[model samples]
Target chain A: MERPARTESPTIGELGESRTLARILPRLASGDAALLGAGDDAAVVAAADGRYVVTTDLLVHGPDFRLAWSTPFELGWKAAATNLTDVAAMGARPTALVVAIAAPPTTPAAVLEGIADGLHEGLAALAPGAGVVGGDLSASTVLTIAVTAFGDLEGRAPVLRSGARVGDVLAHAGARGDAARGLALLFAEGTDAAGEPDPERAAEVRARHPELVAAQLAPHPPVAAGVAAARAGATSMLDVSDGLARDARRIAEASGVGLDFDGEALGADLRVAFAGAEDHGLLATFPPGVEPPAPFEVVGRIVPAPGEVLIDGRGIDAEGWDPYSGWDGRSG
Target chain B: MERPARTESPTIGELGESRTLARILPRLASGDAALLGAGDDAAVVAAADGRYVVTTDLLVHGPDFRLAWSTPFELGWKAAATNLTDVAAMGARPTALVVAIAAPPTTPAAVLEGIADGLHEGLAALAPGAGVVGGDLSASTVLTIAVTAFGDLEGRAPVLRSGARVGDVLAHAGARGDAARGLALLFAEGTDAAGEPDPERAAEVRARHPELVAAQLAPHPPVAAGVAAARAGATSMLDVSDGLARDARRIAEASGVGLDFDGEALGADLRVAFAGAEDHGLLATFPPGVEPPAPFEVVGRIVPAPGEVLIDGRGIDAEGWDPYSGWDGRSG
Candidate 1:
């Protein structure tokens, strides 16, 4: 795609907030769900079900992503995917997104445009018919993106974590450990201060493991499978954002049931599935004798014991990513 | 108010994300608007009007605020007020808020509790019955707060900026320049490396100018007046966030009519009224013969000429606060 003219593109400081917003507003795509779009103090979204399912997530520069490894487009796409998956976990159809971004004064206008492009593409591909309805921009030393997504359940009851009962089956959809492996690869192949790896080496890695790289940079959650599980009478459902075992413990504790994983049923490497976070796959529990929905693999079963997650009749450490404990020393 | 016990209080790093969330979740108050609150992947909020008004704002540590002048409680209050006012500008009743905060791991758990208290207090005092429904937390180099607010129109049509007629009267509610003046006073008082002003001097300033300090640290936007203006047949409306002159230009451009300020009717110092931003006061225009709503003062009139904002028959510069242009050198 031919890039917008960059010679005349001005920094946010040069054009100011209003003018910058004017430049970016036309690039956003608003769908039928938007009663009112950008350029207003507030955007209006149609709530067909008389209720809106809402979730928000924040992506800080150093902790969430390094500018060197990820482009502005990837950053935008990843941010949207993270929040939209949460809406999907509730068995809802995404309606709209509101993004709040803070960047340095020196940030290029082109970077903002790139981020918008990624947002537009992500919504079109991941949550069709949903768009960027509104946003706010401010100045900060490091770049940050805070996104809040809204969805409509279409009169269906929300699938809560506390609904799983003993004798239910646990299932999942989407890749398990690709994102973690991708991050490991990036760290092994050290980049420059700007986070850019050598072009030839980077291209080679991409060709060898394209899916892994994409998983880390631009995740594609199985959003449709959420509704499918709900239709299949899922008693409890959630997106696995912080590793399978750790997130499973959440459902187990909430539902007062133990999740016993069948090693053969998982069909993935235990090491990867237990430690990798940010896969954004759907994890759901369905009542006994109910066939799991298509694309969902039966990985485990709920037992009478509560608050325990076991694999092959043995308990393993459920520890996963903790933001504060995993402070990479880059942040203050 | 007695401060919470400090010695036993754990830092975010010590407690980790899940435990910290467990502590903070109970402190948040969710009103009837929230069908589902925290602990779930997503929150369900009532959108009784069949539509929802959504808006967001980002507040950075150094650019948007200073810890020297504002406590955690005040920061939370001001953040909620800023976004709630945007919902009010759409002539909607604020319903729920979702906050995303990013801070260093060393931040105290007590500070988080204080922020929650402030959010609860702000909602009860400003938009009664509204509450914080959900939120996200992350680790960052500096403290940042991003708030997204949702509101219900309650079957009333949204008052857009494009509706003002040639003979409409422009009115406003709440204090005009107090926040700006308060910010000026804080700048006058110097701070140390840790964003703390000298103890004795700070106490003296606080005692002498309590209202001014409060205005800057914890603004109380007149949220109720928005619904009243809509009921009184407001043609166009918005919140005065970027100074009276600058924000008026938005209404003038949108409505395609010039706004002529009535200097005598304003009943305030012209410079402060025209240049101060962050007042978060409601600015609405009503058709001729419509009595302005109670507590709304007639400050200007709509004229035949379009896209011009004049005061006392003279064009004045509408420059106001621009975050990108106001980097304070304290952030990373």
Candidate 2:
């Protein structure tokens, strides 16, 4: 079926803020985190262990995603997944989320409702008990989603990036070169004659490269593995947001140690696995004798030289991954 | 000294994301709330007694504020204040904030730094010990700020808008219709010939009405009054963001009661006091025999009628506020 023009659907402005909220709020109430959720001035969530981990992330139109290429469901799922990974990176269980979304008044109400459904489904899949506790909505020329996520430590100490020690086993999970590879394909074939991302072209690319496209649109990060790593006595950890080399460099600098990667362990596409961005993988270092839980593949070892990151005795380029030379899928 | 043109200053695009963040992050580290603050995947904050209240609010460029009228400092302060009020209304002591900011790449780095300074100062003055925990920066066409606040309930049950009882005393603190009145003044005399908000004209208006302009720009909402009201056993509470009549109607509907106002207690400008929005005031109801907090000025009483709101025995217009009739200071 052909998608109707934006004008065919009722705009948020025509329905007004109150009615729009009434339409969108119901779809977002997926399960409960604790004491309170939505329809109140503020939401009360369980901290569980006296401490809660907090993080915020923003997604803006153009720099973040193209509406023409990605549906509102994808955008919302990405937004929720983006923040949940941050919480998981802290070795905490995601407890709740509060989102602030701003869109043009002319936006279709269905778009917002679809986003809400995505948020609900994403949380249900990634962090079962976590829920959208509260949210704010407003109008802007550009569509934007700002999410603040909360997580509980469950009495475990937070794993900091500065805790990796010399001789620690460097490990990773849920990351490969796939997301960035998929992104490269999209840029190469997803645009129309005018070089603008077209829905049909994007669909064609997705059909041809299903895994790659899905990786970019919806890479399921190992959220629960974070707490497992913490339980397994992992020393340090972080979410591989930037390319491997760049993010690994962060652990090197923070831990005041060197990271020596084992080339054979880095997958078939070594450079892509090391340089691909937005994989949302868990990178950690465990004490030599502390065997990591399942799914954490050993990638390297921590070394004595402070702030040095090398793969098979050679330093990787500073701008590790160059999958899409012009657009890095971060800020424009 | 005159402010330099945006081009004269180093733009974020030129400075780069890392450099702009380095310039802004330092100003945001006002004080430590607990285990972690910024510079990590997520921040860990203390949620004493195992429960925390969360709320988020967004501020968009044209709908919420105009650059020509509000400096980056004022905008940031307003953003922080806006979310802080929501938390306070929950009868919680704000403990931390996580913000997501999006702006054009061409924006001056100084503007972001100033906003960071404002976020720090606003927190210091309004909710001490509440520091920015984590944040995200992205590029967008319209400048936007989204703030999510965390508050501790301090072992007290949360105050809800639906707890009002018949014959309860309706009291308010901080709100007085001044912000809307000042906004009306700005629209009337502070814009240039093009009807666009202009700096010099806004400055002139501010100079002429210092109190009114300050009310609009930096409303010192009695943040502590909320906790005090909660401690005093207030039955219901809310922050008056949408004017008295409308918000009272919300409380009335939620509590299944009516609100009857006392004109004499409403203040010198009764209509303005009742009709103004963005006052960020604490509006609460006390049980019939319970004494209210000191700062909570009695404004009216709760009655038996369901969802009816009146002032001096007459129903107020549904559009309680007419100040800046064309601009509601909400969504565009």
Q: Candidates' TM-scores? A: 0.95, 0.94
Worst 10 residues of 2 chain B by lDDT: B323-332
DockQ of each: 0.82, 0.56
Q: Candidate 1: which stretches are off by over 4 Å?
A: A1-9, A192-204, B1-9, B191-202
Model 2: residues >4 Å from true position, as ranges? A1-8, A320-332, B1-8, B30-32, B320-332
lDDT of 2 by residue, B239-300 (tens): 88888778888898999998889988885867786677788888899988787887888888
In order, the TM-score of chain B in each prediction is 0.94, 0.93
Work out the iRMS of candidate 2.
Answer: 4.0
Reference interface contacts recovered per candidate: 0.87, 0.74
Two-chain complex of model 1, DockQ on C-alpha atoms against the true structure? 0.82
In the range B124-221, model 1's lDDT, one tens digit per residue, is: 88999899899999998878899999898999999888898898988989877888887776666645456555445555667888887787778989
